[model samples]
Target: MTSRCILQTALLVYFSTTVLAVNYDLLRFQLSSSSVECQNLLLQLNGTTKDCIKDRMNFKFPEEIEKPQQVQKEALLLVTLDIFQKTSDIFRKNLSSTGWNEIIVNNLLEKIHWQIEHLEEILEKIKEEENFTWDDRTLLPLKRYYLRIVRYLKAKVYSICAWKIVRAEMLRSFFFLDKFTNYLPN
Candidate 1:
């Protein structure tokens, strides 16, 4: 029957769509793996939580980044912590030499929990008020700064750990590394 034919066609379309949706992330991972920059960026973004978990669990840095730059590694770890705090989900995996990942994961989760509470308070306050005093002028700067934060964070990820090789002087500026910015005389 015609009705049966329509149902079959619809079902076929739906099946294909759902299958693609499920594999979207896997496709992203696969495509990204082909390129060095893409892989590193993915690693930087995903590795934030992974590395932090490793750090907390006493996971040692991968031999790749565990070179003699002790100061560089420590400073970069601070940067790593900041980015990790901004993003991470449950079901974390360890990527370190030690098992200190649990402690840091707990800490990161606690911070996220508190942030949700704070957001709730803000939402409640917004509902109670019709308009914020000086809202237009005051909120614009905040919005700009928030956008800047996003770019700064991305730049840090790409230029640092994500890149095959990134320079300290270059990264120093992202975190306000003023010392490296000093002008030199010829």
Candidate 2:
């Protein structure tokens, strides 16, 4: 009958639409995974919590930025994190016994600082645009994660600077000590 055929078609369409609906939970899982991977990569690069201080800074989304731009910025961050994570993994896997050259390490550090700066600029720009009136819970986690990373990177930079200073001072002290010893009676 026509009625039976209509009922079946309706049921099929309903089920198909339901199946095509986005799985928000899965997306959340992916987001969390991406964040975790990023954190892990930083840790591997020597940005441990023991060295990096926890920042209490808060981020507020700006109202001037349209929803689409906000979403685009967040996506850009996610992709960038993913790329860093993958590159780090590859570097670790291919690490050589000779170890990384000092110049290379310094270059990498500079690049990391530049990237962090850019991310912070984006966050600042977002906050300065327009007031975010919607459910901010979705973006809060991402912002927090990013701040944590920035803090870690800062700690790493400070540690490197401190290390270089100490090393140079030690070398200078040794040179002086050697000079003093040489001047003493044989």
Candidate 3:
């Protein structure tokens, strides 16, 4: 009877860990697919718009994330999550005023929002496994980057050309994220 109880307990623990790991993998896969979808949608929107090369802003993506290979996996995940969260907020606040096709812009927002939620789930799992907390200060550079973009848009009065440049920049961001995911440990 004792042996039987021990066997059952061990099996339960094994299956629990297995399921948790599988869930993490599933979330990552879903996030990858969603990221690709976002890129395609952005590509389509960018293609339809006139080039705004001269309207480029002086802001840059955070240098820490520029080289994903050198960053720790947890730091990468946290920073990526922060970027998506900020991007979603910026999109919700600005995209509607851009005079673009409403349906496509809304669809893009929905995908981005979904990605944020998915990243949150992945973050929670990583927190549990790694027992670590991320510093908010790490996101200072990203916040500054977004702040500059927002100020630029406001200064331009959210003109179509300005929005076009922002849209292209977002496309570039998604492209980077898609590539960054490849470097993450599976």
Candidate 4:
């Protein structure tokens, strides 16, 4: 046993720098050497090699699964944002017309509801996962969120402008009431 330990120690010193040199062929040769302890040690080393391989494989598989999950989530958000931008263009075109006000308001409200729901869902997912996954797809969700925010602000501005016009018309109509009532032919 002492001689076997000495032999293994000497081999370790010789091969210390070469991590890849521990192969089946080299191990088989060592196992067949005269020392019983060397043979047992070679079997134990084989188990360690298997464990190292398993750790590497386990490390790579999750990355493969996680990457595409990120892409899928991000693509959904990007497409949702794009649809919003196009829908915004329509709202922008129609904002000046009284005829489109009710329909646009309804549509804008629905879009707001959707954005809120999606944003909540996204936030919930992030909270739930919390560093379990990372993806390039995140850019799209964040961008979509930006688009929705812009849409919301634009809608509010249009509503304000439309209300201002209505308020001006009401003021003009009332402006004559006091003067006309007081100047009634006596």
Tens digit per residue, CA lDDT, model 4, 1-186: 999999999899777634423232442232223123212322222112232332221111122122333335323333333333433343344445333345535545454345445534543554454433434454444344435534443555544343333223222222322122222111
User: What TM-scores do the predictions have?
Assistant: 0.25, 0.31, 0.88, 0.25
Best by lDDT: 3
- Model 4 scores a C-alpha lDDT of 0.36
In model 1, which range of ten residues has the least summed lDDT? 177-186
What clash pairs does model 3 have? none
Could you give candidate 1's per-residue lDDT for residues 1-186 as a string of tens digits?
999999999999998756533232442232222222322323333233333332122112222222323323222222222222333321132223222345544554454455445434433443344243322332233234334434543454433232211112112222231121111111
| Model 1 bad stretches (over 4 Å) | 1-106, 122-126, 129-136, 156-186
Alpha carbon lDDT of each predicted model: 0.32, 0.38, 0.75, 0.36
Scored against the true structure, residue 81 in model 2 reaches a CA lDDT of 35
Question: Which tens-of-lDDT digit does each residue in 1-186 have in candidate 3?
Answer: 999999999999999887776254565677578778987777667443446667777579777667788777667777778778877877776565566677877898888888888778867886887688988777788788888888888898887788877777777777777776766666
- What ranges in model 3 sit over 4 Å off? 22-28, 46-51
Off by over 4 Å in 2: 47-186
Better model by lDDT: candidate 2 vs candidate 3: 3
Scanning candidate 4 in windows of ten residues, the lowest lDDT window is 55-64
Question: Model 2 over residues 57-145: C-alpha lDDT tens digits?
Answer: 22222221213234443343333333333233223332232233545544444444554454445444444443323345444544444
- Candidate order by lDDT, highest to lowest? 3, 2, 4, 1
